[model samples]
Target: MPHTYLVFVWHMHQPFYKDLATGEYQLPWTRMHALKDYYGMVEMLEEFPSIRQTFNLVPSMMVQIEEYAKGEALDPFLHRALKPAEELTDSEQEFILKYFFQANPSRMVYRYSRYGELYDAWRAAEGNVERLRRSLGAPGMRDLQVLSQLAWFDEIFQENDPEVRQLNEKGRDFTLEDQALMGRKQLEIIGHVLPAYRRMALKGQVELSVTPYYHPILPLLCDSNIALQSHPGVPLPRRFQYPGDARLQVHKALDYAEEKLGFRPQGMWPSEGSVSDEVLALAYDEGVRWMATDNGVLGATLSSLAGVRETYRPYVWKQDGREMRMIFRDHFLSDLIGFVYSRMDARAAAHHFLDRIRENARVLHNEGRDAMVPVILDGENAWEHFDHNGRPFLKELYRLISEDPGLSAVTVSEALERIPATELPRIHPGSWINANYDIWIGAEEDNQAWEYLLDARQTYDRVVNGPEGAALSEAGKAMALEELLIAEGSDWCWWYGPQHHSENRPEFDKLFRDHLAHVYRALELSPPEHLSRTILRIATPAYQQPPSGLISPRIDGEISSYFEWMGSGIYSPDHRQGAMHGRDNAVREVRYGSDGQKLFLRVDLEQQKPGALAGLEVRVIVKSVRHESELHATLLENGAKGTVVRSTRKRTLGAEVSCAYSQIFEMSVDLLSMGGRSAEMIQLQMSLWRDGLPLEAAPAQGWLELVPSEPSDWE
Candidate 1:
């Protein structure tokens, strides 16, 4: 029977924990989980040897994994996870023994009885861990190794970690030794598993794909102003040309993939499924035969494809008189596995997915048309949440597709190979994000943040394009350009959501500033004060303390509710002790006083290990109840003095510092001064920073009430 459906998914992503400066990896759990999830998925492909899938191994992530596979930086992090086993009590020993007895494939008959004796000796000592340790000391390294291997099975998926997430932000550095270790791991993975992927693609078992370098929101990188149009409250940074920069990003992806992967990818998954006509034209000019975006983009850009009103079908997109095949992803189906399905049983989820494809195929056949359903999502993230480490679901899904007569699977490249390019219409400029740039640029908090970014961008542009521009060597110029490009990614700005406006805002500011600073330094500019002045002008006030007593977190009154995982450590409330890699966590206390117009907020952040102190930042934002006329103050400070007190900065203007004791930092605000009389609500954020940058920060908010000011209320 002719194939009625084509299942194509391309997993694209970079580990946010990979530190750019020293190239060190902070989150070992992400790597450990990703390895199991991805490897398990690949192994499942064995059941349906003929089943095809596309895997886009980001160059950066590929590098990090290779380093771990070769005993580089990650070996130590792995060592740390294994260290806890040394202190296990009697009950813990029993737990380990029972768990691994069912796990290890190479258990010696005598070793089983040996483990039982150790278990018995430890249990006989009750809860005395020293005795247990002494008893296990004989087995020592061997036992620890077993425990280390077993830790991988703990089944807790690592999500956004605040510590690791902060490292991804600007101005943070990983030590050199750490970087070397991570680099070695990347090279190792390249030598080891990457080859398996290459061989699979070469053998037609899978297809390989690639994304733009640094995985930026291409449209925003082209023109920061796109945000101003969509987000009314958000201000545009210095104006940037669109089509020109877009071209650079597209060409860069093609060149990198062709050079590293041995063949030009037939199709590209624009970073984050971000797309527009300008983006598509750039892709086609650079030889991208096809690309895919979220179905929502197609629904907006073209009302219908191939006479089909819906965007779920694969169709050709025309841009600038050139045409390329485009596939609109069924985000609901794809993300079901990435985010939602993790809560379900692997078998049930797999069955449900297979059934959907079957139903789609049957319907298409009944209607007399071919059904090309694009199932696209992140490869590593989805499996981390799945049961059996996503093994059963993946295997079942691939097997059902490969063996079932009703459906067939093909890699994106294979499908694109079957279609020929034709002339296309003029494409528009936009992204899958909010149908415009509002998510990145629209918001009072976002606009204020960009005002500072614009100042910094202009400062850097002047230095680079000035007389110093002529004297720089070719390499220096190239480095400056690349640094600016990397710094311009849109992820930092879009992190503003709900009341969390200042969360990732500072990092956005610092990166834009740092790149500009690099340009000034390279050009022999003097007195860093010029840059500092610009930063402070746009800097918001810091909070007096971190949030405390976070026995439970509620969002919109729902216990432990989490909506977005942009920058704050991917704190999945269900997992205790696991940090959100590349995200931060702060607990907050909100109390309203005197008819509701007066507000008090306390933010508390638990410290990381000693000597990791960078500093803390606090921003208090007051908005009119109607969500208009916003005013804010930002304060930055170093050290953790657990007390609520105010201080002034002699060297800086408008600097009023407040701090609190007991791990709970408080900031008090009266709405009357900042349009509070006419406004109905208020928002405050306190973010922790390392080296003058913001980490995971959540907003605390409340409605305003009319009240008389106490005699104590004056600046």
Candidate 2:
């Protein structure tokens, strides 16, 4: 009677966006996600009493939610959303055009007909304020105001709330009353986020967990050098060792949860599923009975790959008289839900997910042992990409899980009760990414941010020990320390590194520095000059290097040898720009080169799997002075069969291509086919398409250019 226990931990969090000095929230995500995700995620569970899950709520997010619920949050976005359309200044109109349509274009914006119309109008105008201002009158602005807010309302709210439903029916030419009603409804939804979780936890339908206050990486707080353990030779900032701060973050989270939620949380999903031996000790000391991190960490700790059997069980890590149970998230399953399933039909995705779980479970069952599959990921951000905000998918998944006798969806705590723990003698020190701290440390920008934080911490310590600090009020000292803790948050470093990029890069840069500057202001000290400037460098576009020399390699779809393409022109896409949470970039880097007779191109993927590239089409478009031509390649069957490479133009290259799973994808085309003879300059553009959707494009902003080599030089 072996059964599979399914653990779904939805980590809900938003960075602390409030400026303590100004009392104004800098970002509207906390409010936006509150309206769309938090309450509804829990409320939807009521439909299926048999299914149970866990929700990890970060205290900082809850604090902001409370502010919005009480109408104390002075968020500029809210102010703009609530403003009368006719009274909006030109700048305000411009701001609306820039940010109001920030929701998912396909799922959220297009869901509302009027909002889609406004988005199309603004897009058609090429985001020009003057053109949009002339084309879209007050009526357009009013409709945008109502529909922008209305688009974020949870599917449940849209279905149940009369005002929201009426607004949906009205579609366009929304009145001032409609706008005012949307604003009120937003606050009303925000109010439900916390209480709904409390009610769910109380009902035992969901288990509630908490992350560290301000969501700092506890291991790094304990010591920045800990990063070197996972990533040896990584350039680090000045040694930042502050176990006390780490302890405080954990302690505060537990205390806040007990006070706010009317119950003590027994489990902690440390910020970003970041953990170490030291972090475990801290959590265990704080009475955290269980914790979770990605399976990559578990694999690294065991010095072997974590397969299904290794990852599908609970384990105990006991060191130095402190212990806590741990679960490693099924990275593949979780990512499929977060990234892949959004592109799939709801029922099909749900069935595929459940079938995978069942198939995986059947293996363990055959061995006469039960299995535990932990599926954990960010709960809020993925839904925007999903139709109906993923409600249909979740309902289908939950319904399937509830009906299956062999499968049981349980909270982490519930799973622990039924499952026996295996001993993990030691644990790896890393976050969920690659089981390494590279995302938060090692990078030049990440190191610089740590150095800045170290200086601020040193200043605080010196002032507090000196007579000037002793004479300062207790409130001032506390504020200074709070700012230091906020600066310790992992979010600042997430954006600082080269690993990730987003549209709001400058804002994050400013916010991180602002928190550090506030630390000095709280201590009555002048902030450093560096604090006033940005830490972020203007990122170079995707085309980093041009073709250096001729490269003629076998079109075997693999990096056959080190020297095969050494001098190839490389184009690495800057994925940080327009970065969406949980979305994986399929195209890692692209290289192009040419021998006198043929053109060679290669694509490296972030992941190397033939299945991942299956159904994906890659196109290399070349424009020369005289003609334009394209080479199309469709990846299939781990590159074994069904992959076809074709050329569209009068000249054909006899194109050949290959796909190497977990390696490179390469192709070769005849130079004469590309008009290389008549062309003096050649421009290249590479695009990856899946199901007709452009997944990624190289040279994101422009085309890669190469001046054709002189015939004498080619000789």
Candidate 3:
């Protein structure tokens, strides 16, 4: 009988967020995610003992979790959350109002009526601190403090823990004891996360794996110039070559995991799934039996598109008498869970996922070969976007797989044991994105960050290995080395590039440099002046051009002619600064214009028809000086045909708008119905919505201004 082995590896990681010198955490993510994600992820698997999987824990994240579990970690975010409402200073109150409601608006905030009410009030105030202060008294502040923490408690804790359940039931008008109890419950959850993984792994329901000690890109650490292999002619930072540090990172990770979990880990995810011949050799030396990276890398290495048959099996890479077995993740399947599935019904998404897997497996089985499908993605970040932190969907998926006799869920190691492997003479040097390191290198900002890291590394070598380091105490030397390792992490460069963004961009910038500064401080040397300044410089914005002339394009959704929208206003999002990872931006650019009587819009997307936009909705909002109106277009596929159904313009306000889809999305609105006469100018914004959740938006910062032309201007 033929079978499809499903290998699900969940990479659990957070950047090293603690400041060594101050003994304070720069961010609360490590603690917050531990409370919300880590414990539940492993504990839930206990329900389906037959479905086994692997969890990759980075050593940096483990240390932070340990500190948090012991109640030894502190930060401004935690302090503010724990403070009594009456004792909160005005600035602290403002900070709470600004940052406390930073959870998923639909899943987390709305789960609690009080938290949702406070969020609505805050939004209604339009971020006016004075207005918020006047509306929300000490009681409101207390409610926010308790509800903010309560929202992050895992589903298991919410259902089983008495204190957490009591807080959830109370809902509003929380007292000081409630806030204190929430804080204590948070620590209790953090304590459970590591133990839960340990317990599961020992029970053989889970396999524990790990990354480098601080999550550095091992290939880059071994040789920075390796990036040039995939991306020639890319501007690189100063040459940084150190294979010794690469070796040390791997060894340290294995040793730490063994010490903490009571058994040595046999597999490695290699931070960011970054690998090269040199990296494989280093891991091989560290006793790593298996590893994983994106299939895109496998495709580039094979110099062909790696189809299901090519990617659904494990491979062995051998060079210089060293070998390591590897599996390439099914990128599309992994991305669906990470980005798309959250907006779908739980049971439907699970069935769709299993169907895709079975279809792929059927292809291999018909070829008389067994199949192994590897699905890998971040375990923490995706949950917030899901209802009930993704429990229902996971439960459905696991349950279906358990019942299906043809399918079996196994860890990477377990699958590798059952399936024979193909041998590759050489492998490509790349990260997950596009089988290239362009996201972490090449870009000006990325190159600059690398240069800064190089400078810090050189300083550490010169001082610690020289006569000056001899005078330093052993404790100081250890502290300096720890700082250097933390600085080497891939996270700083992740934020430096234009590919992704978060509201805490500046904080990431500061923390990266601060770590380097501590390295110099431990050596008793003056830090470089450049360390005080940020690496980010203002670059060209992504949006380009405003409407210059009239456009009356045909509304068949196709770009009928080159000249139809030649002078239309255009807006493009800077991809480097996008908010999420592993998501495709359906809209490439938005062009809008007016032909005296009607306002015209053409959405140029990277894809058309039943591609990325299928089963999604695009919303167009027009905000005039006095009024706001909107139009909705739902994308659907009927059999083999695709069509976009535009709803009757809700909040029409006498506006006659029509939409069509062909090669592009086109819409036109009657100017008279848009309150063009009532306002001198109007602002327009477009957003991609799924399951009523706004996934991504154009302009990102503010609305695009559209000025109504004077009647005589046409002449």
Give candidate 1 misplaced runs (Cα > 4 Å).
15-20, 26-30, 67-191, 227-238, 242-244, 304-309, 417-430, 444-457, 470-478, 499-715
lDDT of 3 by residue, 5-64 (tens): 999999999999888877888778998899889999999987898999999999999999
Clashes of each: 65, 2, 3
Local distance difference test values of all predictions, in order: 0.49, 0.84, 0.83
- What lDDT score goes with residue 530 in model 2? 48
lDDT of 2 by residue, 429-469 (tens): 99899988888888888998999999999999999999898
lDDT of candidate 1 over 1-715, digit per residue (tens): 4354565675646434444433555445446544444444554565577888887655545555556666565433444324344454444444333333222222222223443444455458675655555666524423433333332331222123232223223111233333333333333323445666666778788888777765667766666665543344565545655466567766776676677668877777777677666677677788887787776666555544422225435567764477778776776677777777777777788889877766666665666655666788877645545555566677777776666776778777666555333333643444555456665555654554455445544655676678867887776666656655555555445554333344234434444444544544444442122233223123222232222211212111111223221112111112122222223344333332222333444343444532122344343333344332211223223223332222121222122222333333444444333433422323332334333333433321222222323333322
Whose lDDT is greatest here?
A: 2
Decreasing TM-score order of the candidates: 2, 3, 1
Model 1, C-alpha of 406: deviation from truth (Å): 2.3
lDDT of model 1, residue 153 = 31
lDDT of 3: 0.83
